[model samples]
Target: MTLHTLNLTPHGLGERVMPLAPTLTLRNGQRWVAQHYLRYQHTVESVSALLAQIDFDAHTPLFAGQDEQGVYVQVGLIGRENYDRSNTLRVHKLVYGRKWRIDADTPTSEIIQTAFLAIKKAREHEVRELLTVRSRDGKTSAAFSNHHDLPLLAQQRDQLQAGNHRVATLDVAAAVQHQLASLRFAQRAIELVQVLELSAGRVLIDVQLGAAPLARQLEGDFPEFEQLALCVLLPAARLHELPYALMDALIEHSDRHVDETFRFRGFARFSRSNQIQAIADLSLQTRPYAHDLADVQFEQIFRANNYEVDASRAPALGEGELGRKNRQLINQYENLLGHLPRGYEQTHETKMA
Candidate 1:
């Protein structure tokens, strides 16, 4: 039947929730089904068939409250005597004595709403199934070796069921690739830690020399990164304010200078590993600030942290004062260029002098 409006009782809510004229609708067979048991003539037969065939014994029943509209029938079951989250539509046989005050109307809004919701739920389940299959097939080619027959792999991946053999293999491969990539990136990050640990005298040279050579070795392309674990890989600068207190402490000292210099000292020494290798991760993370640092020096000690809860604005640093504060910064940077060992002194003098 077509919906007119809804007639909602506030159910103790204020004016916020009131019934409309036709809030619910019925399926085609619902009216016929309701008509068959208007007086519950077939109630006994329906109940007997439901109990004998379908499994309703798990549900509890409410014997007393039968509304006038006949929307819901509350019944008591053998196990549960109290009201619960059981769907009203799953009810098969509802036995009411002749003298019981059951609702008179066979087709109430409650019944209609339940039936409509069931149909909607069923449709959603089917849609999810189709989408899941499509997503699997689409993802298979990227995950499997290209040398394998594409069509065969696609067919096998698509045909995988909940407990099928190929399904386990696919799941395992996906999981392993994800984990291996994570380990690799993690190893790279550890090498970066080592880079950061290098003496300030060598840090800049190490980082600058490392970045280009590593890039060249990797063919100037970063590896594809995958998040196989709970935590994400972040640049040293980006580690600020991470949930882990250790990360916050490690990154807290990094500022506009740290961002620009870490690549020369910290990232240059970064070794590639199987644990962590996301190419774009660094792009998204906080990096060294872009400054005229082409002739910068690296600092020996990091600047003391600057944090204030009530400060109105950041304290400004003039160029010379900043240079004095982070002298090692330029050294590290120039040291990177000096790693070439040829004419290194000339470039270092020009940049740091």
Candidate 2:
């Protein structure tokens, strides 16, 4: 459906907007997918201007919203959920006629670095798979160790899958090697800037980064609240000092090296309350594997930060300032957990028992 033909309802303060579902095609024949739901606050005029700037043939408008500030329009690239920051800034500038900037900060840096690492690791894995192969005679030979053998072996594997094992191996190794070389060169030239720009844009949308108002607003509607367990809560002031690299490593390890032990989901920043805080959502499982992995990750974080890991180091009531803070955190955790759905309490109790 086209933006002009979209069924938009009057939102807050008489603004018109509507939510778009994933995989829905727009007038220009592009599908939309959102990594997470987002709301944008914009005005009617601004929305119209933004629509005019959009090349429907190239971009996809995911959804729209309105608020006290203005009308917010969520837009994405043709086939990606997460797009480059330049695209978002272009939309903002088109609507408001001013440049929008995202400050380079630690959180932004970490997010970009994490994304780059994930992409590089994936590519290296593909290369490894291509390197590990056997010949048609089911034997390893130095003759098959040439660069051409990689794609030839890959094609042979495809032929085997198609039940055509008798197909003769052709001398197309040089072409495949050339293609691989070109791909490698292009990846080296563009992947850095591309990943950084894409991840920088993501910072404005990521709920964990606490940069997007719409993302924060939608946090209240997160469906996994019942399944989430608060693993750690640190003062907002300590955000810069926290072991983010360790956290990223643990997440990568869980995702790549191990099975589904546990996932370090993301962070939730609470700044509206009396005391600003950052909560790490390490929704741990009851399984032994989960416990072991959690223990190791936490221990590394604590040690790297020079925090005590022993139970005895935990402050006693009225003994030390650290004790007071620890008690307050325990109370906060309990309060949050208690307010969850009824079944959650039972499951948590059973797990503890």
Candidate 3:
């Protein structure tokens, strides 16, 4: 049976009807069916049954909500085996919902700069420790902070002198350390700045180092060492790669299974339809659905319409890195959808018409 004739409530299908007043007529004279946001409830068996009947295409927008037992019914867009109990399906679509304004007292840009400088200082301290050595007699000691200090320690055989094997070792080690520190600093700075922009500056680093020495310096309090280490070691690429891989998976899966009648085309196809709906929705309303629904309000709307929006899974803008990444991934996915072709026949027909 067609979707319109299906027993929506009995079969556990819930949908938000698009207002008829706002419809699009393409230049080809074909009326575009405004995309519908469907939320499906009930057990996996019933949902699977519903999936088997409907002929989903690149223009279909469907979302499966968590049931009363908190088990999410798998939407056939992704492989059934890959589907998890968690809400990974909706993450690439939902918005942050709240304003992420920057704080006037402590901007994230300044904090990141301070942390970067501290890491540099710590590296210098480590190099200094490595260069310092004591004589075998235990009567004298030589210390060198940089290459300029080499001359001062030249007379002492135990010290790192010009052309000394120890000096060469120190130079090589220092250069390698400097290069690594510089690369890490640049990567961390970019990722943190992106997070700030994505969150509208609402999220800030919890701790700031200012001019204080890092723990490795061993001179002053090291309260900021953890944050500094996190800045230096955290993998910025991981934050971006996860979502990129997910998008690639969706595309690859769609291309491989495009002709499979029993399986639903992957998220890339659903994304295309959702994007069209978003365009039409924006044309009719002042704000998009994300900004229109607050966290609690989103849950309420979902419940009122016979769907469930898991509060725990709903990402918050101010929650820091994960939240920022989620927003970024959503934008990237939507952009991908925009450039994608609808279908072979549909695209050709539109161009001919």
**Runs in model 3 with CA error above 4 Å?**
1-3, 10-40, 54-353
**Candidate 3 residue-wise lDDT, 1-353, digit = tens:** 12333322333433233222122444445443333223333344444343444344432223323444442322222111111122223222211111121111222222222222332333333323222223445432213333345455566756532231222322432432332222211012111211211232121111112232232233221222323421221122222122222223323433333323222323332243357776665556433346334456554654454322333233344345655554445544422422222122122222221
Q: Residue 31 in model 3: shift from native, Å?
A: 14
TM-score of each: 0.14, 0.16, 0.20
**What are the per-residue Cα lDDT tens digits for candidate 1 across 111-179?**
323322332232222212211111323331112112347687678995743332222322432432332
Residue 259 displacement in candidate 3 (angstroms): 7.5
Sliding window of 10 residues with minimal summed lDDT for model 1: 201-210
Per-residue accuracy of model 2 over 256-276 as CA lDDT, tens digit each = 321221112221121133232
RMSD of each: 33.0, 25.8, 24.8
Whole-model lDDT for model 1 versus the true structure?
0.26
Ranking by lDDT: 3, 2, 1
Supply candidate 1's per-residue lDDT for 51. Answer: 22
Give model 2's clash tally: 9
- Candidate with best TM-score: 3
Error of 3 at 313 (Å): 2.7
- Could you give the candidate ranking by TM-score, starting with the highest? 3, 2, 1
lDDT leader: 3
Better of 1 and 3 by TM-score: 3
